[model samples]
Target: MADKQLMTYEVGEQMNLMALLKNVTVRVAKNGKQYLDLTFEDQSGEISGKFWDASAADIDRFQAGRVVRLAGKRETYQGSPQVRIAGLRLANADEPHQPGDFVVHAPMKASDMEEQINQVVFEITNQVWNRIVRFLLAKHRKAFFSYPAAKHNHHAFEGGLAFHTLSILRLAHSVVQQYSSIDAPLLYAGAILHDLGKVIELSGPVSTQYTVEGNLLGHISIVDGEIVSACNELKFDLNSENVVLLRHMILAHHGLMEYGSPVRPRLLEAEVLHQLDELDASIMMMTTAVEKTSPGEFGERLFAMDGRSFYRPNEPQAGGPAVK
Candidate 1:
């Protein structure tokens, strides 16, 4: 994309713009001067800049999640676009915009997403699975619907955790219908609860960061423990086949040990859950990349996709969807 149409700029020129401080960090320069590494974002996208010789007060005021009025010039450094900060200050209360006006949000409304996912909950037919899913959903209701699935990755915006889950649920429904031997209830429950641990693993949506427990134990372990606790609280037999199978779905959803799964999926449903989980996340990441890529060119490298960049076609391709 052209630097003029870059992310937040409404005009095709460098000028003062209201941008959200997506991230801010203090660093020591080689000259022993303190500087601020800043990331600014709007509904469109993000740009990083540096504020050299930052005061302690500047560090305190230019925090993540705050809206700022900034004058920056779009510049290229080492083959990547960067913002050269001229001046910036926190947006005043009298300003028309606020923090939320610049933050990226899920395409779907939170209430609508909630209602649609609730409809999928009905498809979970197994009584044991149904009970645990409902209980856990209720327990982490707000965060599950509001938190991003990860600090940075596919679906890393507001309500992303729920949106990503819903996408998997939709894909799983088609898979179950196509393959009758597949346990519909098991797959549905697994999709709904697969990343619910993110509510505890990641902090709230804005300027997200991992918690101490999230860093040490990770979401996979955190959620497995949650399932075990839920079973105990529900007075359900923790050793029962149903509980074991349900837990296995979450436990092995990451697929392999290296990816974070404690055990490889031995059951058919568990295997399907892992595949669909990966599929939904991959699609979201690619979709976002394709949207940004200019015609007949490759987008930026996706670290999650093994540092690969996808090509955007100038004309409609015969076999696939076109970049929008």
Candidate 2:
């Protein structure tokens, strides 16, 4: 029989697992001995491990992001699963280890997401807007497809940035159809380029964290700056209406000043972008919370949603009254 995945290991089970050593920290125990506090991850999930009385040599041997073979037993501490490591060593060259096997990513395949995004880009008809969007997309395609939308919160897995962008573009399509007054080209470009700055803002796909720029300028400002630079490089008129409107969409996507938008949305397209962005993020966040909670119970308080816990209903509601 195949071995159980990391998430399936139950408390008290002896596990001989191979996983990526994602993080490591040295701490002094009460007895004055140093110990290694580590995080191990495989595609299924991640677990913490404590190596009691670890020496300096051990720290050097098992660095972060390296694959390691571990013999341990699972235990629960503060309602979370952790492992007590009895033995561990760097995974040897002969081991059947693959980096892709250890990373958590968006549910959709990366290639599929990229194709969908490209299709949306093809839909943009404004020549200058199309050129600028295509140029930026081609430049950042690698990181754009690999990076998570955020370190944590909604769409916080690999390929999340692309997944989130594509999701918003799909929403924009429906919104344009519903309201023919909305400019389809401008809305489509706004949806595609809304979060382009995150590629520079985030560290990378694995162990995602905010970079110094991400903490200071944030994605909104970063992408706004990118828009200016891209236009300058392409020799597109700085004062062109399309250029200014696209920049406005990125800067005001957060919707309000307190939410990190430098300026409140002023244009109809910008306002639509803000609303669509919020709707997508809120749906993903609430859906994720609901899925993680036990049926008939409330999920943990969500800081993003004003510290409210969502209830996981035991059953789906029946269809409501049909529209006459």
Clashes of each: 0, 0
**RMSD for each model, in Å, please?**
3.9, 5.0
What C-alpha lDDT does candidate 1 achieve relative to the native structure? Answer: 0.84
User: Best TM-score goes to which candidate?
Assistant: 1
Residue 30 of model 1, lDDT score: 100
Candidate 1 stretches greater than 4 Å from native:
1-12, 28-34, 75-81, 315-324
lDDT of 2: 0.84
| lDDT (tens digit, per residue) of candidate 1 on 1-324 | 322224644323475777888778899999999999988877777777899999889888888888888887876443234688899998888873566666678889989999999998888888888989898999999999888888776998889999999889889889988999998999898889889989989888888889988989899888888888888889899989999999999999999999999999999999999999989898888878777655776776788899888877786768967646
Q: Which digits, one per residue and each the tens of the lDDT, describe model 2 over residues 1-324?
A: 655667777778999978877668899999999988888877776778898888889878877777888898988664346888888988889884665567778889889998998898788899888988998998898999998898767887788899999999999999998999999998889898899899999987776668999999899888888888889899999898888888888888898999998899999999999999889888888887776454666876778999887887776546854222
| Candidate 2 local lDDT, residue 52 | 88
lDDT (CA) for every model shown? 0.84, 0.84
